[model samples]
Each structure stands twice: as C-alpha cells, then as structure tokens.
Target: MKTDSLVFWWRSLALLLAMGLLALVLQPFFGGTIALATMLVGVLGLLAYHLRNLHRLGRWLNDPGPETVPESYGAWEAAYGQLYRLVRSQGKSQRMLSAALDRFVAAGEAMPEGVVVLDSQDRIEWCNPKSMQHLGLDRKKDLGQHIAYLVRLPAFQQYLTAQDYSQPAILRNLAGGDSVLSVQLVPFDSTRKLLLTRDITQLERVQTVHRDFVANVSHELRTPLTVVGGFLETLLDLPDMDPASRESQLKLMFEQTGRMQRLVEDLLALSRLENGIEIREDRVDVRSLAQVLATEAGGLSKGRHTLRIELQEGAGGVRGNYDELHSAFGNLVSNAVRYTPDGGEIRLKWRVEDGCGAFSVEDSGLGIEAQHIPRLTERFYRVDRGRSRSTGGTGLGLAIVKHIAQRHQARLDISSEPGKGSCFCIRFPTNRLLEPEELVTSGQ
Candidate 1:
C-alpha cells in the first residue's frame, strides 16, 4: 500500500512536468504556446493528486477490511493517521459500553425487588424477572405496553401520573387477590423512569397480627381493671358500711386480682413458648403425674364431681420437660373441674398405645361445638366467654397446653359434642414412650 501511494504521487508529478516541459520545448516546432500553458499544467497536476487520494479513501470506506491501508506521503499522511486513530477509539468505546450495559442488566435481574424501566410516557422498556413474579407480568410479552394499563390498580395509576414521587406508594392487589406491593418511581432526565416494586404481603400480614395482638391484650386487661377499680372505690367510700358487705366486696376484689395475676402468668408463659425456649427431655413419671393432677382436680371440684384416675399397667412414662408436663396435665384437670356441672364425672387417664404415650382428660361437661374445637387452642379463644369469665378462666389454658405438647413432639386430640361431653387428650410419639423393662434398665 505504501509503495502504491508513492507510485501514485510520483506518477502525478512526473506526468504534469512531462506535459509542461513537452509543451514549452515544442513551442517553436508546433504552434507557439504561451507561459500560461505551464501554469495550467501545474493546476492539472494538483487535481490529479487529489483524485488519487480520494480513490484510496473511497475503497477503505466501502470495505475497510483488516488489510493494510495506503500510507500517504507528505502533507496528507498526518491527516490520514489521525482519522484512523479516531475510528479505533470510537470502536473501543462502543465495546466497553456494551459490556457495562450487560453487567447492569444482570445485577438488576438478581435483585429481590422488582425493577422496571419506562419511557417518559410510562411505556415499559425493560423489566427484570423479579418484577414478573412480583407484578405477575410477562417480561417479554409485556414490553412496550403501558404500565398503568397492565397494572390497572387505582393506587398505581394515581402514583404513575403524580408529579411528585418523593415517597413510595402502596399498591394493593398488584398481582391480584390480597397481594400488596410497595412501589416507587424515580425519574431520570425527565424522559425516563426507574420503577421499583417489592412484595410486602408477608410483612403486612405480620404487622396486622401485631396490631391485633396489641388490641386483644389491651381488651383483656381492661375488664378486670374496671372491676378492681370499682370495688376499691366502694371500700374507700363506705367506712361505716356493714361488715359482711364490706367482706364480700373485698373478697370479690381479691378474686378479680387473682384472675388478673393468673392471666399475666399465662401471657408470660405463652411468650416464652413462642420465643422458642428449649425444653429438657428427661423421662417423666406419667402415673405419678396423673395422681397428683387427680388430687388437685378433686380439691378444685370439692367433691361436686366424680373424679377417676387410671394409669395403664406395665407401661413406662413419657419423656419431656417435667415442669411442662406437670403444668399441662394440671391444666387439663383444672379445665375439667372448671367446666363440668356439679356431680358431673371427670376421668383422667394415662396409657400407652402402639408404643406411644397418651394423657387424656374426659369430662362430662358442656362440650364445645365442632367449629369452636378448631380454635380451642388459640390464645384467648373461648367456647363461651360468659362461662369462661364466671369460672375464673383466663382463656390461655389450652393455648399453653398446645405449646407444651408441641415442644414435646406430641399431639392434642379433642372429641366433643355440645351438651354431651368433651375429651382433651395429648398423644406423645413413640420415640417419647418407654416400655416398662426399658424404663428400669435405663434408670430414668
């Protein structure tokens, strides 16, 4: 190519000089030409040189292959080199930009929250896969579609057109149903927007539960507080009232206070259980536990009901935290005593079935309805609120029992018919049950 460029320049100069000299030398032989002819030949030479360079530049523009480019000599050489450098620099810049854009897209795809790119008109340009899951959108198919048209949520439509977007907007039913999304839009350069959406369904549910729990706790505390406050005011005002009347009022106040204390205790116990306290799995003597519960139940009943205790013969006790089992068994017995009518029969039984241990309290009481049975173990749930309050029940006994049973890998089974009876039982897994011979051998 260099040789070609040199040849091209050499030919132009040689041809122009040859024409000029020939014309001047033949002035006498041929028709005499003027000095202006030589000057005209010089101008023709410059035109020829420019045409050569233009031809080479045209070829490069057409193909621009990896072959060597012509190396121009003299004045035009510097200009040619500078142009090549500019072309190469622009190519490098383009490749680097492409790579950076790919990386940016990958990062957006991996994000937990949804990301969407939109034109100034809120037309979808690009979206990440997370956005598909969050907004139930088809990334490929939904491209170029108006976001407002696809979302169709009133809150989202309002947020999209709102001039100020300093804060996020909560959009319910974003993916339909109860789904909730926290969506925010950031405008860039007044012509494009970046939309971020996060699925806040689970978080919202937790917040709701917290609110309900707070409200329920407040309500539970209010009643006893009102009772105690009223009774105290009466006692303070009546300095010379009847002694028996005063005694009754004070006694009622004491009972209400005691009820509140029991409630607080149960609440604390439930909190500990919910927070996942580890329980010791030592072997528990079911027979002895049942016997102790029977004694407590009899006392609570005051012989108003027939109480029976039965422990299966030649069966080893279950394995669990001793205090937890004791408390659970005691609660069952107490619930029976509390709910059963006077002269009603209550039976407490501990038995081993299929290598599993079970403790059941069967009571001939006003039994729970089928629908209420499912929520019996829910904290503060009650079959009959009036009866529960009358019996000094805190409504947390069954909840506590459930937590204990679950911690020990057991299941509480209930069978009841309203006006007939209710049976509350806990079934311990086979792993927790020990045979009598194994019990003696293990010395537990």
Candidate 2:
C-alpha cells in the first residue's frame, strides 16, 4: 500500500475508536445493549467499505484492461491512481526500448559490410541486404538453412566448424564469381554468433597494385643504377682507358641516366593524375592539339615510323586542362611511334560520333593479344618488357592516358589483334564536347 492509503486507514481507525468511545460513554445514558449495537453497526460499516475497495483492487489486478480505474473514496482512490501512473510509466519505457531496437536494426541495414546472425548450429537466422548481395543469398529463402550447406565452399565450411574466430577468413572467387569476401565471426552470445563480411575485391586490387608498383619501381631503378655504376667503375679504375672508349662509356651512361629520368618523370606524372590534379575548364581544340602531338611524335620517332594526322572536326572543342589533355594525347602518339616498326604507319584522327568527341591513335605495329588488352592500362605492365625497353618506353604511357581520360570523364576503348593492328581511342562524352558557337565563345 501507498503512503496515502496508510494515512487514510489510520484516520479511519481513529474515527472508529472515537465512535466506540462515544458509544461506551453513551452506555451510561442508554443501556449497555444499545451502546454495543451502535459500536457493532459502526464497525460493520467500516469493514464493508474496506471490503468493497479491496474487491475493486482485486478486479483491476485480474483484468487490467484499457478501461479507467474504478472510482472509490480514500485509500482505494489513491491505490487506483498510483497503479495507473505505474502502468503508464512502464508503457513509456517499453516504447523507448522498442524505438531504440528499431534504430539499431536500421543502422545495421545501412552498413556497407554484410551482417549475418547465426545460431549455434551454424544456421542462418537473419541477414542484412548487403549480405544478400555479397553472398548471393535470399533473405527469406536462406533463413533457417545451415550456412555451410548453403555456401558449399570447402574452405568456408572448415572455417565455420573451426569455432576459432580469432581472425577473418578470406573467401576468394565465391559464388562462382569474381568476388572477394573477408569474413569473420563474432560470438556475441552463448548460443549465437554474428557473421560479418566485407567485399574486399577492390581493396585487394589496390593492395596488389601497391605491391606491383613497389616491385616494378625497384626493378626499373635497379637497372639504370647498375648500368651507371658499372660504367663509372670502368672510368674510375681504368685511368689509362682510350679517349674513344671513355667517350662511348660516358655517352652510354648519359643515355641510361636519361632513361631513369624519363621513368621517374612518368611515375610522378601518373601519381599526380591518380591523386587528382586540377582540371581546367579551358577550351581544347582537338585538331590543333592532335597536330601538336603528331609533331612531337615525329620528333620522338625520328622518322622511324610514317605518321599521318586526320582532323575530322569532332565537336570542334573539348573542355579540360590544356596541358593535361596535351600530355595524354602526346603519350598516346608517342606510344604509337615507339611501338610501331620502322616502316609502320601511325594514323592520328579526331572525329565526332554520336555527338561525342573521339581521338584515336592507330598503329600498324606489333599489336597486343586480346587477353593482354584488358590490363594494358596498368602502370608498368608490359606484354614484352624487353620490347618496351628497346622501344624507349617508360611503361606508363597508356596508364597516364587512362588516368587523364578518366579525369576528363572520357573512356578509353582499345581494340587490338596479335598481328593486324591496334587502335587506341579516347571518347569524350557529349557534355565534355563543345559545339561550334560554344567553342568560339570559349575562345578555342
């Protein structure tokens, strides 16, 4: 009972005592039997009232529906009001807990990584949408199914049964596809665990690129350094060397140093492009730019390859950084010159197709195989390392071209056969191309 109920009960007891004392005092004026009757009547009335309130309280405890608490006087009223307040408080707490649970679920669903809840039996209980994407699982269909049976990967089955989730397991080429998932288990409760999966294909690719970059850079620098060091040792130890021999040695050393310098410059250029250089909104004339690049290619080729420039007025202009676009176009033209044979033909063209500007460099050289075409843009990747060195390439030309094209929202389409020829084209979207009037106003 409540404080108010206790106080009301005490007050009623005091009133009953005063009535009994009055009845006892009235025994002298009236008879003893009359006084006893009066006391008995008053005591019975008090008992009846208390019994009625007790019944109301018992009924409320039994049913406890949405109806208001029944009316009563004194202690019963206090009891009813307190019960209602307690019920409302508990309802508010329950609602708050439910809201918190909902927010937690929402947050889990919004996560990029896949989340799965599994029972102790390695059965799927719940999974987020990302899990569906990463694991190729249907939430409704896969639920209650054993995870090992559904996954069907031997390594994954082993991982699940191991029960030692200290580290994540790498699942490569899962779902008979090219996806890489890093999976780890969190034993959150005694009977269940949380399975987490992250699609790490892109991360793995980046790591591979980083490793290859390091190895390639070391190899490239080692070659030139070795050559230069050998030549310097020859000059230093052989003081009586002939002047002609010394001159030849020095010339070779200079060439090696130049090669190393070119390699470093290309590496730095590629790094800048990858790290995001500022793209200017200047108007770039495809025809004029191609002409300049072709001229530069002629110098680089030194008449080793026959070069031709074809300007077909592709949307007149493109909007981008002039120097960057020039560098990209220059790299493509120079690559063609270096890769093509002495008497081979290289055609440079700029034209519009489907309202998009396309710049192409076609070379009648040792064309790439179809399998090697996909990774041609990877930095330092070479189909023929020896041929690349002989052709005086830094092995980053196409990579640089790819980055610049991407920066300008362009796509590089490469078509090549083993012996026929290879055509490399950078196609700019229509928005990146400027019409005649726009080009004129843009001062191209």
TM-score of each: 0.72, 0.80
Report the lDDT tens digits of candidate 1 across residue range 1-444. 465456556766776776777777767666555545665766776787778888988888786533445668654575466557666776788889999999998999999999999998889999999888878889778999998888888888888877678999998865557888899999998789999999899999899878876777787889889999998888788888898999998888888889889989999988888889788776777887787788888788988999998888976787778888888888888999999999899999889887678899999998888998998887778888899889988888999999999998898999999999999999999888876654432333
- Model 1 clash pairs? none
Best by TM-score: 2
Query: What is the overall TM-score of model 1 with all chains considered together?
Result: 0.72
* Alpha carbon lDDT at 253, candidate 2: 91
Q: After superposing candidate 1, which stretches have Cα over 4 Å from the reference?
A: 1-110, 173-176, 188-190, 352-356, 413-415, 437-444
Model 2 over residues 15-80: C-alpha lDDT tens digits?
Answer: 699878979898999999999999998889888988988887788878774365677766466767
- Clashes found in each candidate (C-alpha, N, C closer than 3 A): 0, 0
Candidate number with greatest lDDT:
2
Tell how far residue 132 is off in model 1, in angstroms.
Answer: 2.8
Q: Lowest summed-lDDT stretch of 10 residues in model 2?
A: 435-444
